[model samples]
Target: MERMALGTEGIAVSRMCLGAMALGGVQDKETSYAILDRFVELGGNFIDTANCYMFWLPDGTGDESEHLLGSWLADRGGREDLVLATKVGRRPSFPGGGLEASEPLTSERIAASLEESLERLGTDYIDLYWSHRDDRGTELEDTVAGFDAAVKAGKARIVGASNHVAWRVERARQVAAATGAAAYTAMQNRYSYLQPRPGVRLPEGGHVHVEPGDIDYVGNTAGTALLAYSSLLSGAYTNPGKPLPEHYRHPGTDARLEVLDAVAAETGASRNQVVLAWLCGHESPIIPLVGVSSLAQLNEAADGLELRLESEQWQRLTEAA
Candidate 1:
């Protein structure tokens, strides 16, 4: 796959980032290590994880994914060769602190969060640091100033927003432009044919009203990259045997499947390559984060690297989804 830069931050990364969300938790140590090894073996240099990842898992609560990646980096002996990204705030739901989205991300929380992430990842600097979620209660100025502080402190290289709104992201860039603070260089969101389920209105009370292009709607306004997580509906498009499970299937998923099945039948490409290629085909710049559990699966997912689908094919898939 061709490598893409993380916005203007200049951090070069593979178009397909290996998301380590399931690391050290859902998958065992051996399996996680094998997945990492396979990821690198396939020429994937961009790795993503978080301090609170998989904290909701029955087996983890703290930097499990980071610890696993850190350990693997030690074994691989080339931490410098990889571009790593992680987040702070909103860790797994603790008993009283349940991993609920209600938790706030404040400056103090960010500072403490990074220390733990650094310790877990065995790294001195993070290529990209994200807020993970928008802090609706926190002032935009507070968020911008805090990110500026992190860049100045040498703890984080670039700051970005995750699970954020287009207008909020635009205002954040405005905050930076107004005060010369650090601006967001990327956005992380769960965008996929299945996740949003086209035409399906998001649940009313929380983080809703997110329209299409919100990732780039703000990016085009600020010139940042849109980093897509759950890019392939958590790998549902690739499985040919059974339809996606109840929760995994989104409204647009079946439509995308129809096109994918046709493409798979024609080009001899797997359903995943077709779906993933469609993601990369968007008008808004999309860099889908790839998450895997095995070398075989990694290899399978890696087929999307540089696999550019035709315009008609892209349209077919887009229309289906």
Candidate 2:
């Protein structure tokens, strides 16, 4: 529950952010509540969710995570006590159960996405709003200008991006510099000890899933922080008894797992802890967003904040993985 300044601004939040992507979708409601409650009890005050969260589930599409999180805020008594960040774009799901036509990033899309998110979250303005994913078709000027308009309208206090490369972030930063608008102050992406490449090949004729290397804190500029989601490798580190899911079972992963095991044993910490804590050693600010389905898992991940790996161990794990 230790706090870190989000971006270079006055917005302060917990070092351990509660990620609600799987909430109300993969995780049952009762269990999700227990996990969230435990996160708060442990002093975590940052919650990150998105409008498009969990719409990928076979059960439903869109807004379940936000609605549930908003309900938690209401129950918790003060929404102002927490720093909330949500995103737009990256809608891979459709209302009728098939992939919809790809959406572009522009003012129209931004306004539509924000309205839906605000409606679902039952809030007037978000503490932080993000572009979610880079829109190759949209001009950075247009996107930054749109966000500037939002800031002027008091729709959001700050804006940022997720899953973007260093150059794209720099481009947006430059646009802000030119216009003197509200600039991106944070980044969120799939960063962790596992799979450092960060890219996924574009589907046949579909949008490319390019890895954003700048998504890492050490590579990010000052005044910006990277929220490392998938911090536990989607339960691979936490659930040792279970084999990794089909998608994560790639070549050289076994070697990475072995390295994680060695680090965990040498440090008397869990593999997830090593991965999460190793991120803290990055040259820039790195905060791992812990996603848990149970309070016990939450406790284990929370204890990870105290785990310190030796420089040798960190190097060995990185090299071996």
Candidate 3:
């Protein structure tokens, strides 16, 4: 697998980042371990998880994903070979509290959360730590300083902003610069080849759609990368049973899907593969954070990374909407 530099941290990661949102929560232990093993065996080195992963599940306690990854790392015995990333700020302070009652990004909470996440993952340091979501109630300076402290203490090599708009991200970077703290070098948001109608809200809570400004910000900024979540729309592109979400059922979707199908036929690949290839070959160069429950899904995504799109086809896909 090809690797790309993550921000200015001097870290190289796989183009496709495996999202471990369901590793130990919804997915059984045997299936989760098998998926993790196959991902590593395929030369994948980037694995992303969060402290609150799958906590909404009926029997979850918000620690299943990280705990499972820790067990896998212990059994596999190759922690240094992979680029591990986890997040804070989205985990609820108490069980059954929900996302509305999630932890704030204050300095003290950041410190405490880092300690807890480290213990859960059974690692001394995190390659990349992310602010899972923006907390408007908290002072921006406090949040920036907290992440900076993590970098300063060597607990996290670099920091990122997830689910934040471009303007807020810029504001946070300004705060970091003024205070001489660590600025965010990476941006993670919900992005896909087929977009929703403008001004429509996503059904999923805490999901911020990537905007045009985000693309420009990442493209113009030096030493920064964009990690796109929901890049495949939860298998909506190819799965007959998984219909497109209500917000994505506009006319633009039909136009885009037509173009996408044409491209898939031209390349003799699955629709999912074409979408992943388009994302990897995007003008700004997006890293698709894919989550899978089975080995077949993982293998399909791996193959998608190997498929390169022609310039014309890429342009057509981009202009379809």
Candidate 4:
């Protein structure tokens, strides 16, 4: 797979990022390790996870994903070859308290989360650390300064933001610039070839969708890259059993799917690969965070790096959406 710049910084990573959300909970340890091994074998270097990764299970716990990744890293060795990223905030519903009780992005929370993540991952530093979501209650400067402090203290190499809107990202950057703090170099948000309906709302929590204004901002930003989560619409484009997300099942979706199907046939690529190629070949740099539970799914994402779309084909797909 081809390696590309992760953000404005000098950091580089594989074109496609492997998401480990299902590592510990949905998939067993053995299966998760096999997938991770295959991903590394295929030259993937970027792996993303969050501290509060799956809290809804009956066991009522999180960090299972991080623990599994840590185990794999121990077996694999060569930690220098990989780009490790994890997020804080988004308190999962557990026993004592949840997101409703506490605000993330505070200096104390940021520092404490970093320490816990390091302990779980068995790493001293994180390549890219993210504020899982914006804490509207806290001052922007405080959040920026907190991340910068982590970077300065060698806890995290770089900081990023996820589930943030355009204005929030810009404001945070301005704060970082003014205070000489570490600014966000990349944005992780929900984006895909298919667009959600006008009135569609996510089963509400901390999830943030990418808006048109966010696209404009990223297009103009020099060093920032967009790490699009759910870039393949959760495999809706290819899997017959995987229906399109509820928010994305609008009038325009069928049209977009038709073009996607035609292009996939014409290019001799799978629908998943075609959608991924569209994101990679777009005007703005978008590195898709593809969540894979199996080695076959990981292979499909890896193969997508080789499927390039012509300008006309891209235009057709975009217009159809």
TM-score-best of 2 and 4: 4
The true-versus-predicted C-alpha distance at residue 274 of model 2, in Å, is 1.4
Leading candidate by lDDT? 3
lDDT of 3 by residue, 1-321 (tens): 899898786899999999999999989889999999999899899999999988899978899999999999999885977999999999999989898999999999999999999999999999999999989999999999999999999999999999999899999999999989999989999999989889988889999999999988988888778899999999888789999989999899999999999999999999999999999886685799999989999999999999999999999999987
**Model 4: residues >4 Å from true position, as ranges?**
93-103
lDDT of 4 by residue, 120-232 (tens): 89889999999999888887887888899999999888888999997889999998988888999888998888888875678646668888777778778977888899887
Error of 4 at 205 (Å): 2.8
- Give the C-alpha miss distance for residue 256 in model 1, angstroms: 3.4
Worst 10 residues of 1 by lDDT: 201-210
Candidate ranking under TM-score, highest first, comes to: 3, 4, 1, 2
Q: Model 2, stretches more than 4 Å misplaced?
A: 92-94, 97-102, 196-220, 240-242, 245-255
Model 3, which residues run further than 4 Å from truth?
Answer: none
Model 1, range 219-300, lDDT digits (tens) per residue? 4654577777766655556565655656436656666567678887877787777667777888777778878767877787
Off by over 4 Å in 1: 92-96, 101-103, 198-210, 215-223, 240-254
lDDT of 2 at 54: 72
Total backbone collisions for each predicted model: 4, 1, 0, 0
Q: For candidate 4, give the lDDT.
A: 0.85
In model 2, how large is the Cα lDDT of residue 216? Answer: 49
